[model samples]
Target: MEVLRTPDQRFAGLADFPFAPHYLEIANAGGPPLRIHYLDEGDKDSAPVLLLHGEPSWSYLYRHMVPPLAAYGHRVLAPDLIGFGRSDKPAARADYTFERHVDWMSAWLTALDLKDITLFCQDWGGLIGLRLVARFPERFARVVAANTGLPIGGGKAPLPFKLWVAFSQLVPRFPVGWLISKGTARGLTAAEKAAYDAPFPDERYKAGVRQFPLLVPITDAHASVAECKAAWQVLAQFEKPFVTAFSDGDPITRGGERILTERIPGTKGQPHTTIKNAGHFLQEDQPARLVAVINGDDAA
Candidate 1:
């Protein structure tokens, strides 16, 4: 697979993203080795708090949430999932697949030998991260699911999701920054907007971004339907500390948090919150609340 690495200069001077980049190459991942970029902060030996982002956004999405969590005595590790952010981007959309995404992340997790994880996943982050938890439950200590879900392909896609899928494919230029801004409740500033656009200098670098929405399992014939069903089997038995922190303004994943709260054995009495005045990217709309939830700071 031909991969595109964004020019490091494109990432320079990014507003609010001050953490240095770290790399780990995934060897034998179908084709050439791909370097995954991540933000590793706070105490190295502290219990890991893994932050996973979804489509069109990267570790940069967690810039506001990372420092406080790190300061709260947790090692924060936020990674750019394969094609987004500073990670290597596969040149063609076909090179991106839901299973391959799972495999790549599984490799990255083992490579770091990270354990006793606290997962805060959103968007496609939940799609891939939840699978990791099901496949390797021992690695996780707890889960805080925000604006994400494990969708079984037996049902139809939500109307908003279907429209998003269509828009991603048909749009001439994949506007990364604009898309992120649109998803958040409050709009982004000029500099903040540019940072989201930083990873993809051009259209060729956005293949993964273009393909992520389509990878969501919405039909019985979808590529990931069977495995997603299998993952659900594992999750149904998950009794870890699970909490949901969905926003009030996202129509796309409006009712997704219920899947976890109602099904997962872990969420019996946990505090699940609806982030008011927030949208799909609550990290942008409600960063303090997100950070508070991640750090167990309910007072916020």
Candidate 2:
């Protein structure tokens, strides 16, 4: 598994991103350790808020939310999933698998020995982050799911997602910045778009990005179908404080939050919100609302 690490310089001068980078190397099958990069801020003693981003994006996605959460006396930690952001990128698409993704992050999570976590997961973040919760339910205290789901490969994926899967594979140049901008309601400034593009210098670095959409397990034949099903079993029994903060403008995950609210016992009395006027990347569209939800702010 030949892994490529993005140059630290690419991340320099990113718009609205000021946190210093921290790294941990986790074991990789048939290869040397893989380095995962993350942002650690706020009071170290406080129960941590774990922010997970999804396909084609990185911890940079949480730039607007981190500082406030940290200031509110919460430890905020956002790791770039392997093959995104400052993390080591596996060069081959075959090297990226849904289970391997979960394994990689699970190792990172346990390595930090982090506990009493409040998770804010979006996109593939939810796919992977929720699995972490299922695998180590004791580590989490609550969850905020946004624009994401834990698909068991039992239902037909919406048309928008099917189109996205096709686009992720067929596009000549994977447009990381453009894709992120397109998923947000207010879109991104040129610099912000460039920041999203910072991780991948060229096509070779995008194997994980290109492969993520295809690994959604939308069909029963998908490899991770059984694993997701097993994860769902754990989620169905999850009684922690779980809340949904879905946005109204996302076509791909529209109404997806219902599955969570209905299935998870934790949703019984928690406040679930629809971030109006925001798109898939509500972190960019409504970061404040997300922060408020994470903080349990009544006004949110």
Candidate 3:
């Protein structure tokens, strides 16, 4: 697989993103090892709060929550998936796959040997992060699922999501920054939008970003449909403390949390909240509430 790494300079001097970058080499069976970048903050000895971002976004999405979570004496970890942020990007869209992502991240999890984890998963983060929970349930202590889902290709996807899938494919130029801004209630500042676009210098750098929307197993014929079905089997039995903090403004996943709360045993009796005046990218719209949810604050 031909791989492309974004120039180190693109990430320099991003506003409100002062955390240092950490790297790990993920071994690819038939290809050169790919580098995955992450942000590690706070007390290393404390149980980890793993923050996983989604498509077209990176660890930058968590800049607001990381500082406070770290300061609260919890270890905060946010990793850019192999094709996003500072991680190595494969040149071809075919190199990006749902199973490969799961494999890559699963390797990252075990390599770090993270245990007693508190997970905050949004967008693809929940899609991938929830699978991780099902794969390694003993490692997680609790979970906060936001604006995401683990689909088994069983139900009809929302019209907005269907429109998004079409748009992601049909758009001539994949505007990463503009796309993220549209997902949030308070649109990003120009600088913030540029931060979101930092990883991809040109269209070639966006093979992963371009491929993510299509990877969602929304239909029974899509790849990983059976895999997600299997993961749900495990998740249905997961009794860990799970909370859903969904935003009110997201059209795509507005009512999606119901599937999780209804199916996953872990969600029972939890403080599931509906964050008002926020959109799909609730982390950008309401990071403090997310931080409070992660910290188990009574007010959350």
**Cα lDDT, all candidates:** 0.92, 0.94, 0.94
TM-score of each: 0.98, 0.99, 0.98
Backbone N/Cα/C clashes per model:
0, 0, 0
Query: After TM-score superposition, what is the CA distance of residue 48 in candidate 2 from its true location, in Å?
Result: 0.3
Which of the predicted structures, 1 or 2, would earn the higher lDDT when compared with the native?
Answer: 2
User: Considering only N, C-alpha and C atoms within 3 Å, which residue pairs clash in candidate 2?
Assistant: none
154-250 per-residue lDDT for model 3 (tens digits): 6677888889989999999999999999999999999999999999999999999999999999888789999999999999999999999999998
lDDT of 2 by residue, 1-300 (tens): 788999989988989898899999999888879999999999999999999999989999999999999999999999999999999999999999999999999999999999999999999999999999999999999999999999887678788988998899999999999999999999899999999999999999999999888898888988999999999999999999999999999999998899999999999898889999999999999999999999998579
Would you list the rank order by TM-score, best first?
2, 3, 1
Q: Candidate 2: how many backbone clashes?
A: 0
lDDT of 1 by residue, 1-300 (tens): 888999999989889888999999997456899999999999999999999999889899999989999989999999999999999999988999999999999999999999999999999999999999998999999999999998887888878888998999999999888989999889999899899999988899989999888888878878999999999999999999999999999998898888888899999988889999998999999988888888876665
Count backbone overlaps in model 3: 0
